[model samples]
Target: MKPASTMRPVRTAEAATTSLFHRLFPVNRDIAIKSIFGVWGAYFVFVTSRFLYVAQGNVDALFVQRILMTSICITSTWLLYRLLIAVRGRGMKSAIFMLTLPTVVLANYIAILDQIVFDHEAVVFDFSYLLKAVDFASFDWAYVLDEAFTRYFIFAGWGALYLALSHSQDAQRMMAHSRQLERVNRESELRALRYQLNPHFVFNALNSVSSLIIDRQNQQAEKMVDDLADYMRAVLTGGAQDMITVEQEIAQQVRYLEIERMRFPERLRYSVDIDQATKDWSIPSLIIQPLIENAIKFGVSGSDQPINITISAQSEGDRMRISVANDGRVIEPTARADDRSTGTGTGLTNVQDRLRTLYGQNASLLLANSKDGMATATIILPDPSQIFQDI
Candidate 1:
């Protein structure tokens, strides 16, 4: 993910503006009013405490005076802040040009109005009377300057924080969209790969049948065609869904092997040891087919001794583990291995990719050579609860 520092400043400024307006309505408006009132109330109480000490107990009048001053301050600050934000993007020079004079004018107006409104003795907005009422000698221009700097710091700090927050929210939404697109792309590729397997396997099986027909083995050719038809039917059934029960997947594998069995009649054989519990589990459709095809291509198709392939599935704790082992030795570690008679390297590659897409890193396909003179491919994955519990 890109950092916020890399984000466009113009967009950030626009988002901040939007956030400010959104903070001013309905429930948000209520909150802002409450917050401003609370600040005034606290300042009013503080002023009343001072008046009680100064006048030796006449606190009500001084409390009212503080409320008027506090209200004037809050309203003036809010309005000034809005005006400044409105001109923020035109650069510091433009912002200062648009805001400084208006803000000074507003402050003077508020100062004079508070005197006339709160002090009924004052008949008009008089600068000298307002200055005297506020205690001119104790005005403290240095303190006023300090307060002005503090107000700017506080406002600008909040503005920066709100801008950062808005950027973070937008970044989260973007990341989620990107992740969704990646998932859809992966699923499309997997579906396309799954569909491609049926045809590739078909072409190979038909080619084998052609060879047998040329050799005048009409009976074996007929058996191959029947197996092909059954396999195609299974493909159609499984292709209709993204996933299928383990039992259905096994049925498809059996039909596929039957076709190959005809091609290498006495050279290939297989066994199954599926757990009753696993029969109800669901796996990605056509996932195991390509793995089985890979095993046959490398381990059974052209081995000197008649090859025996065994497929077994069982529940291991909360997960299902399936292993397919064939009686074909792995080439020596130091030797360069020859390509298998059947070209299915790409199929097995697709199998790995599909497994990763479906199960992330949790699902795995492992290949190893056992000391018992067999090459094995194992798939380990979580059992689908929907398939089991629903049934």
Candidate 2:
């Protein structure tokens, strides 16, 4: 089981950053653009006021200040877009590099073009004029790089925040799934256990044992008692667990079936075919025995034809499939409920429930009546090794 407290740090960081970005910026692109426009508009008003104070009524310098502020706003908007992609997958370094380089070249070009080429009076700006206006002392290339780096540093911090938030949400979802699966597993085990202790079944088996004693078969009757004891012990002890190996459960079933064979020596015949590869596979305990019992009771006994029950196991991909078929009449709606009820309907019901619990609707107990008077009940369970590895 994964620890409740531990989490992947990268995933955690990404989730937090993603969530924070959504909360702060929201999804409405028009609204976001409008909000940015409003902020820049206000900044322009504040800058105009400052320029007026400094020039003391000179309108030309105020015009230049307005142009500088507008250029800064456009450059900032472009950088913000690049920062968004960086938050998605690109780390801090990529975000900063991409955002800064383009914005710096563009911003500097806009400033130089303003003073040199577009001087309002058509004053031509030559190489020397643009070079002198570069102002190495204050507006040097190093200074521009430093400013761009600082702006992107803030953007990187926001990206980290969103990343953390994304991971937390994913962890929360997995935790919920784990809890649900655990509950379903418990229900499957409980239902499997409950069906194992069918009252009518015990009563019938005991009655059969008594008949053996009445016929003066004292030795056989004692053996029946011993077999019943072992079957009950396995059912009781193994029922608590969710699953047991196919090999172990089948061994118990063989013992139980041998006891049943004693009751109908000539009437009942049984055969089992299991692939060697699937013997050690796992399945919900006691799943097959009930089907076999049903076959013997409904198909073989009291009918003119001798009952031949066949149990087979196979594997498909990561799952193990098994089928139990018996030579019996197809159960019709008009068939007496009392006759059918003699065996454990509880067992069949439990098998279906366990299948649903473990694999939701994908796993199932399938029943079909063949043309040759063969009734088959097929059970498909997830392979335990594969299931364990997946979890």
Candidate 3:
């Protein structure tokens, strides 16, 4: 808007770029045809421009003569493109060697066509005239052979270049397609692992609800049922497609504990300790649920006193740390991590499997315990920035 003159150059450059792109890459994605058109078109423009620059006369006739020459070159190369496509790597070495015959024959045809057009001031392809033109006393067979020799390489070189580029592009396209399929298959596997939790978790939650009803605690039972519905809704909806913000995950787990609170209203208390900086960070959804379940199962099975479960998230250098810890049992330093008192450690194993699937070896789940009646299950993500990048 500042000046029309200044804007004109930008618009002109954009138009030129678009025109060049269209010239190189045609409307349809035909690599063979596209390569021929682009290379030959560039060659024609360059050769014609050079001729016009260096020569002193006959600009209009030279333009027409060059147009005819370019048309012939395009047609000849197109036939080569078609031959390469049809052969498609069969007897490739022998086939290319045999192509020398056609290349040599066609190259001589170019020389003949040029001679006829120059003599008659018009295009002609008469075979009889070809015999007549060679009746000259000064006919040099040596020069013709030399010119044909050079032209042979030009034709052969063009065909070889096209094949190399076409094969390379095809390979690249295949590799990209393979990577996409791998991603889809991995996501499907993650989903299968995620859904494994549903049946086991629902069975436990229903049993807890049933216990509440038998104890004549109708109000707590109703509250737990409502919380369970809300929790399922949050999980099966938008946030469950493999990743969830630390904040959303914390919210979902809080709902889970609210249901469990019905069972141990006095004995179960939980806390969430998420740093403000880590709330928006993402992790695999429902990853921490199993650790919490194990905490309650192992911690409450042998104790009559209150147990405090804590969920915490914090940043650790380039990594992010998420832990579910409980005051249920002190993890003895000598105890195997997979060994717990009340269960077969399936919950911890499941969480560990999921972390390995999502982050490979770059992420880990660790079980640590302290002497002060504290047991911790922590997940360490080495690169939070890469966790949800693909998703």
Candidate 4:
């Protein structure tokens, strides 16, 4: 009589109960097999020991019946275990209701089955008799409560064990997921730091080539192109790496300086002073290139006087201190706004950001004018051997 969209199949009480039972006790082949092995193994041992001691070597129908009843009890407990796991997180009240009701019903059902099928006694299934005692005018509830009480411990034990195992598995899964997310985030940050170096270096190098082309220095331009090709090959090869040794980094910077040398000729003179003890120390790749580019941009490009830039490194106890200094004329704070020579000026900031990302507070970059009037950029790195070990 209803529209097709509104039409719903009516579920009877018995059908609904069966659906709820199946939903709460969903079939898990592994858990089912484990329950059968574990529950039956323990039940059989207990029943066999009791029968052997009480029956005194006599095999009887009662002993067989007891074994069968124990098997039924174990089966019920395992089914209850499945229900408890399903009802977990559904609140304590729901869990206790499901547990207590099923146990009581199953115990009563077994008692009825024992009287009818195994004992063959005329046992009346009446609630009135449960309230009456052998003595007149006295009501005793013990007989009615005996079977349910006896089975409750077995079900409770199984429930406790199941809850413990479930909680353990959930904690392990949460820990694994947390670790996976941490690894993903660390990798994403490393990729971001790597990408920042490439474009900034390429932009400066290309700008130099463009300047040479404008000046019509064909011979020097051709040589610069060859040098640039070699420099790019090295950059591309090492771009994917997160860290490089001090020596490798210096070699890369030397390639960059060689290109710059072709442009400046006699106007630019630079030197690298590195301690032999710190050469194998690991540092972030291309970290120092931008500082050198900064030196070139502000030092040689802004001055008519020949500017000298120096990069020096030394070990200070557990730290490696590196400095890039240039003898360029310093613009006073008042002249900074009028100085057209201060380019986009992102190189120093880029170096600082990458240092912060890679080393947090363990590394630092500082910019200051030295005593001899040189614009000095200093970087202090943590102990490279210890840093590598930490990574």
RMSD of candidates 1 onward, in order: 11.0, 14.8, 8.3, 10.1
Question: All models: lDDT?
Answer: 0.67, 0.65, 0.73, 0.69
Sorted on lDDT, best first, the list reads 3, 4, 1, 2
Better by lDDT, candidate 2 or 1: 1
Best by TM-score: 3
User: In candidate 1, what are the lDDT values of residues 224-332, reduced to their tens digit?
Assistant: 8888887787676548787888898888888888888876788889989999999978888887776677677667655666888888899998899888888875443
lDDT of 4 by residue, 1-391 (tens): 7775554444465688888767655654345446545755686678667755574433454555556667777677767766776676887776777667786777666555444333232233322433333342232345435645655665666555555556666688799897678657655775665555546456766787888899997787788888888877776665777788888888988888888877688788989999998898888887888788878877887678788889888998889988888995444435555655564545666777667666667788877888888988889999754431223
Specify the highest-lDDT model's number. Answer: 3
lDDT score, candidate 3: 0.73
- The window of 10 residues in a row where model 2 has the poorest summed lDDT is 118-127
lDDT accuracy of residue 277 in candidate 2: 79
Order the numbered candidates by TM-score, best leading: 3, 4, 1, 2
Winner of 2 and 4 under TM-score: 4
Cα-lDDT of candidate 4 = 0.69
lDDT of 2 by residue, 1-391 (tens): 6565565776788999988777655533444445456555665677667754574443664456455546565456535654554454566566556545654554555444434433333222222443444444434455455544543443334334433444465577789899879877667665645556656558877998999999999899999999999889888865675577778877877887788788778877888899887888878778787787777767766577668888889888777789888886556424445564554265677777666655675677878887887888899877564342323
The TM-score of candidate 4 is 0.62
Which ranges of candidate 4 are over 4 A from the true structure? Answer: 1-74, 85-154, 157-161, 197-204, 210-219, 312-323, 327-349, 352-362, 366-391
lDDT of 2 at 281: 87
